[model samples]
Target chain A: MRNRFNEQLEQLNVELIKMGALCEEAISAATKAYVEGDRELGERARSLEQDIDHKERDIESQCMKLLLRQQPVAKDLRAVSAALRMISDMERIGDQAADIAEIARYMEKSAILRQVPMEEMALAAIKMVTDSVDSFVRGDLALAHSVIAQDDQVDSLFLSVREKLTALIAGGENGGLCLDLLMIAKYFERIGDHACNIAQWVEYAITGDYEDD
Target chain B: MRNRFNEQLEQLNVELIKMGALCEEAISAATKAYVEGDRELGERARSLEQDIDHKERDIESQCMKLLLRQQPVAKDLRAVSAALRMISDMERIGDQAADIAEIARYMEKSAILRQVPMEEMALAAIKMVTDSVDSFVRGDLALAHSVIAQDDQVDSLFLSVREKLTALIAGGENGGLCLDLLMIAKYFERIGDHACNIAQWVEYAITGDYEDD
Candidate 1:
C-alpha cells in the first residue's frame, strides 16, 4: 500500500510537470504570435489553453484522491496541498497566455512590438514561469528564490514599456494601439506575478513555510 | 466528534463572511476615495487589505486543519475545499481594491469620476462580491448564477468607461489622468472576474460539479 501511494504521488508530479510544460508552450506560442503577427500561432495557444485546463482538473482530482485515500501527513501532505495551489497558478498562467493570444488576434497592426520592450518582458516572464515550475519539480530552493527575484526585472520592464507607450501617445501615435500594447505589457506583468506565486508555493512545499511567513 | 466538526465548519463560514465583508469595505472605501479625492479613505482601504490578508491565512489554516483532522468525505470535503478556493478569490478582491485605492491616492484631481461610469461599475462589482460570498455561505445556486450573470454588466460598464475616457483623451484632455481612470476601471472589471470565480466555486461546492463541467 505504501509503495502504491508513492507511485501515485510520483504520477501526480509527472502530471504537474506536463501541465507546466503546457503553460510554457502556451505563453511561448502566444508571444511568438504577437511578435510575428501570426493568428495561427495565437490559435495554437488557445488550443493549448484548453488542454491545460483539462490537465488542471485531472491533476486536481488526483491530489484530492491522494489526500483522501492515503491521508498523507507532514511533508507529504504539504507537497500534495502545495501542488493543488501551484496548479491554480499554472492554470491562470495558461489563461493569461490565451488572453495575450486573443489580444494578438485582434491587433489590426503589429508595429507596437517593435516600438516597445514587450518582447523582452514577455521572454522574462516566460522564463520565470518555466523556472518556477522546474524548481517545484526538483524541489530546488535556490532556483525558486531566483524565480521570485526575477519578478522585479519583469516589473521594471513593464514600467519601461508603459513609459515608452506613453511617450508614443504623447507624440500623437494612435491611442488605441498604444493602449493595446499597454494591456499586453500588463498581462505579461501579471504572468510574472503568477509565476512568483508558484515559486512561493514551491518554497512552502519544500521548506514548510513561505518566504513572507 | 461530528458535532465538533460541524462547529468548526460553521466557524470557517463565519470567518469567510468576515473576509468578504472586508473586501466590500475595501472596495467601497477605495471608490469613495476616488469619487471624493479623499486620501484618508484610500489609506483606510489599504489598511483593510492587510486585515483581509491576515484573515486569508487564518481561514486557510482552519480549512487545512479540518481536512487533515476530520478527513471529511464527499460534501463535507467539498465544503472545506471550496472554502479554500473562495478565500483566494476573496483575497484577490481585496488586493484589487487596494490597487484601486493606490491609484486613487495618486489622483491629484478627482473630476474623472464625474466623467465616466466608474461609480456604477464599482458599485456593481461590490454587489457581485457580496452576493457571491453570500451564495457560498448559503449554498444558493440561483444566487451564484445571478452573481455570475451580473459580471456582464460590470464588463459592459468597463467598455463604456473606456470609451468615455478615450473620447476625453482624444479631445485633448490630460492623458495621464485618463490613463489612471482607465486603470481604475480595469481593476473594477478584475474584481468582477474574481467574484465570478468565487461564485463558480460556490456552485461547485453545492452541486459537486462546476458549471462548465
Candidate 2:
C-alpha cells in the first residue's frame, strides 16, 4: 500500500508538470501570434488552451481520487490538496493566454504595438509560470519564493507599458490599437499574478505554511 | 457518527453563506463608490474585501479538516472538494470588487462616468454571486443554471459600455475617466465569470457531472 501511494504521488507530479508545460506552450504560441501577426498561431494557442483545460480536469480528478482512496494524512494530504489548488491558477493562465491570442487574431496587422514591449512581459510571465510549477514538483521553497518575488517586476513592467500607451494616446494615437494593447498588458500582468498564486500554493504544499495568507 | 458528519456539513454551508454575503456587500459598496464618486466608500469596500479574504482561509481550513478527519467517500468527498474549488472563485470576486473600488478611489471626482450604466452591471454581478452560493448550499440546480445563463447579459453589458466609452473618446472626451470606467466594467464582467464558475462547481458537487468541459 505504501509503495503504491508513493508511486501515485510521483504520477501526480508528472501530470502537474505536463499541465504546466501546456500553459507555457499556450502562452508562447499566443505571444508569437501577437508579435508576428500570425493569425494561424492564435489557432494553435487556442487549441493548446483547450488541452490545458482538459489536463486540469484530469489532474484534478487524479488528486481527488488519491485523496479519497489513499486517505493520506499530514504532508501527503497537503501535497495533494495543493495540487488541486494549483491547477485552477494554471487554468486561468491558459485562459489569459488564449485571450491574448484571441486579440492577436483580430488586431490590425499594422498596429504600432512595438513600443509596448509585450514580448518581454510575456517571457517573464511564462518563466514565472514554469518556475512556480517546478517549485511545486521539486519541493523547492527557494524557487517558489523567487517566483513570488518576481511578480513585482512583471507588475512594474505592466505599469510602464500602460504609461507608454497612455502617453501615445495623449499624442493622438489610434484608440483601437491602444485599447487592445492595454488589454494584452493587463492579461500578462494577471498571468503573473496567477503564477504567484501557484507558487504560494507550492509553499503550503511543501512546508505546510501558506505564507501569503 | 453519521449525525456528527452531517452536522459539520451543515456548518460548512453556513460559513459559505456568510462569505457570500461579504462578497455581495463588498461589491455593492464598491459599485456605490464608483457611481457616487465616494472615496470613503472605497475604503469600506476595501475593508470588506479583507474580511472576505479572511473568511476564505477560514472556510478552506474547515473544509480540509472535514475531509481529513471524516474521510468522506463518494458524494461526500465530492461535496467537500467542490467547496474547496468554490472558495477560490469567491475569493476572486472579492479581489475584483476591491480592484474596482481601488480605481474609484483615485478617479477624478468630476469624471463623467454616468453613461456606462455600471450600477446595473454591479447589481447583476452581485445577484449571480449570491445566487451561485445559494444554489451550492441548497443544491438547487435550477438556480445554478440561471446564474450560468446570466453571464451573457453581463458580458453584453460590458461590450455596450466599452462601445459607449469608445464613442465618447472619439468625440474628444477625457481618456482617463473612460479608461477607469472600462476597467471597472471589466472587473464586473470578470466577477460574473467567477460566479459562473462557482455555479458550475455546484453542479459537480450535487450531480457529479462536470458539464462545462
Candidate 3:
C-alpha cells in the first residue's frame, strides 16, 4: 500500500508540473497577444483555460483521495497540503490569464496604444510567472525568494504604464483605446501579484515559513 | 492531551475573532476619515494596525503549536487549517485598512468632495465583514455565502465612484483630491474582497468544497 501510494504521489507531482507548464503558456500567449494584437492567440488562451480548470480539479481530487486513503503524516502531510495551496494559486493564475486574454480581445481594434509600455510590463509579468513556477518545480527556495523580490519591479512598471496611459488620455489622444489598454495593463500587474503569491506559497511549502516576501 | 488541544483551539478561534473586529473597526474609521477629511480618525486607524499585526503573529504561533502538539485529523485538521488561513486573510484586511488610512491621511485638509456614496459603500463593506466573522463564529454557512454575495455590491459601488472621479478629472477639475478619493474607494473594495476570502475559508472548512465566491 505504501509503494502504491508513493507511485500515486509521484504521478500527482508530474501532473501538477504539467498544469504549471500550461499556466505559463497561457500567460505567455496572453502577453504576446496583447503586444501583437493577436485575437486568435487570445481565443486559444480562453479555450485552454477550461483545460487548466479541469486539471486543477483533477489534482485537487487526487490530493483529497491521497490524504484520506494514505492519511499521510509529517513530510507527506506537508506535501499534500502544499499541493492543495499551490492549486489554489495556480487556478487564480489561470483566471488572471483569461482576464488578460479578455482584455486583449477588447483591444484588438484599438489603434491608440502605439508606443505604450504596457506590452513591456505584460512581458515582464509573464517572465515572472514562468520563473516562479520553474522555481517551484526545482524546489529552489532561493530562486523563489528572488521571484518574490521582483514583485516590486512589476508594481513599479504598472505605475509607469498607468501614468503613461493617463498622460495620453489627458492629452486628448487615443481616448477610447486608452481605457482598454489601461485595463490590460492592470490585468498584467495583477497577474504579477498572483505570480508572487504562488512563489510565496512555494517558499512556505519548502521552508514551513509564511513570512511575507 | 486531546482536551488540552481542544481548549487551545477554542482560544485561537476567539482571538481570531477579536483580531477581525479590530480590522473591521479600522476599515470603518479609515473610510469615515476619507469622507469627513478627519485626520484624527486616520491616525487612529493607523495606530490600531500595529496591534492587529501583533495579534496576527500571536495567533499564527499558537496555531503552529497546536498543530505540533495534536497532529489533528479530519474536522479538527480542517479547523486548524482554517484558523491559519483566516489569519492570513485577516492580516491582509489589516493592510487594506492601513492602505485606506494612508489615503485618508493624504486627502486630509482637502476640499469637501461631492461623492458621498463612497461613505455608504465603505459602511456596507464593514457590515459584510462583521457578518462574515460572525458567521465563522456561529458556523453559519448560509450567512458566509451571503457575505460573499454582497461583494458584487461593493464592486459596483467602486466602479461608480471611479466613473464619477474620472468625470471630474475629465472636466479639468482638481483631480488630486478625486484621485485620492478613488484610491480610498479601491481600498474599501479590497477590504470587501478580503472579507469574501474569509467567508470562502469558512465555507471550505465546513464543506471542503473550496469553490470560488
Pairs in steric clash, model 2: none
Error of 3 at A212 (Å): 1.6
Highest DockQ among the candidates is held by which one? 1
Give model 1's DockQ, 2 decimals.
0.49
Question: What lDDT does the true structure give each of the candidates?
Answer: 0.88, 0.88, 0.76
lDDT by residue for model 2 (A70-186), tens? 879889888888888899999999999999999889888655678887889999999999899889878899999999999999999988887787777677776667777888998
Which CAPRI level is candidate 3? Answer: incorrect
Give one digit per residue, the lDDT tens place, for model 3 in B56-125.
7788668656665666777777777777777777776787787788877765464436543787788888
**Alpha-carbon runs more than 4 Å astray in model 1:** none
Count of residue pairs whose backbone atoms collide, per candidate: 0, 0, 0
Model 3 Cα shift for residue B85 (angstroms):
4.0
Cα deviation of B140, candidate 1, in Å: 1.6
TM-score values for chain B across all models: 0.97, 0.97, 0.94
Of 2 and 3, the candidate ahead on lDDT is 2
List each candidate's DockQ score: 0.49, 0.48, 0.17
Poorly placed runs, candidate 2 (over 4 Å): none
TM-score-superior candidate, 2 or 3: 2
